[model samples]
Target: MSLSHALLGLLIVEPRSGYELTKAFEADIGRYAWQAGHTSIYPELGKLAEAGLIEVTHEGARGSRTYAATDAGRDELRTWLLRRPQQSKVRNEDVLRMFLISALEPADAITMLRGIAQHTAAGAAELRQIRELNGPATQRGPAGFGLLAAEFGLRQFDAIHGWAQWAIEQLEATADGSQDGAAARSVG
Candidate 1:
């Protein structure tokens, strides 16, 4: 989804300063869904204000402005949410690099795949920790929808981590010449 829609959706939950909004993205959806930084978010908040989609609800110290979604913003977000989204173009750099693994020697490829397995495992652990910390409270409120998305992300990481571990084992077997090209045969 576009950052604008994301901002509007978050504002609908409660009024928040730009810093708080940035933190929400960093700690929540930004981790698994979309990525945005404070620099990007502040400007989008301004645009939303200019378009009458959101309004400043309060001002805090150091010019910190809290914002909430306007009625118009809520309507806009609801409309966008109900419509079918355009198919997203996948752009995962890690997966793309996987496509180039054959260009490396088998030992190097094995190393790279092992690294992926480690990374995926770490991501899954972090998501699990987040769920443990926040799931119960969030699942009981209007925010419960977030639990569903978080579960999906956790599952995705689980699946990827499992596959990565399996691939690493297959590579190790091949390295020891115990599988007689089992990895290649499996792909074919």
Candidate 2:
């Protein structure tokens, strides 16, 4: 995700100090979309100021400054939003581990599959809470896109959780069949 564009979007919602923006990332935006610590956010803010895409709107105690997006920033953000996104290489570590599950013993693989199911279920529950808090998903307000994003996360979590459960069942069936075969061979 583009930190600059994400910041622009947030500023479009409302003017905010650097500290407020960091809080935004930690609480909302970073949860499902972009993540930026103050180090990266501060530099990007300076660049946005240099480029006239954003301006400092207020100065508070201890040299704290609040910033708002310029008209140009809105235009830029709109253009970026309209552009077609390019396909990029996916690097999901959890998916990679699942692909290599055969490398693990059956018991270890079962444990990992169970862990995935539990984690995804918990993630889905968290997204559901976000969905409730964000309310409706109309495009007419600041909270609109957030509700949509939360819905997307909820769907993803449910799908992964379902897959993990199916995988666990497959592993258990195989284990049971192997045990039956072993018993038969010993008797013969």
Number of the top TM-score candidate:
2
Clashing pairs in 2: none
Best by lDDT: 2
Number of backbone collisions per candidate: 0, 0
Give the alpha carbon lDDT tens digit for every residue of 1-188 in model 2. Answer: 59999999889888999999999999878877887899999999999999999999999999999999999999999999999987687888877998899999989999998998899999899989877777777655465757877888889999999888877767776788765655454457
What's the distance in Å from true for residue 156, model 1?
Answer: 1.4
Which lDDT tens digits does candidate 1 get at residues 30-118? 87777899999999999999999999988888999999999999999999999987777887797888788779888888888788778
> With candidate 2 superimposed using the best TM-score fit, by how many Å does residue 36's alpha carbon deviate from the native?
1.9
Model 2: residues >4 Å from true position, as ranges? 139-145, 178-188
Clashing pairs in 1: none
How much does candidate 2 score in TM-score? Answer: 0.84
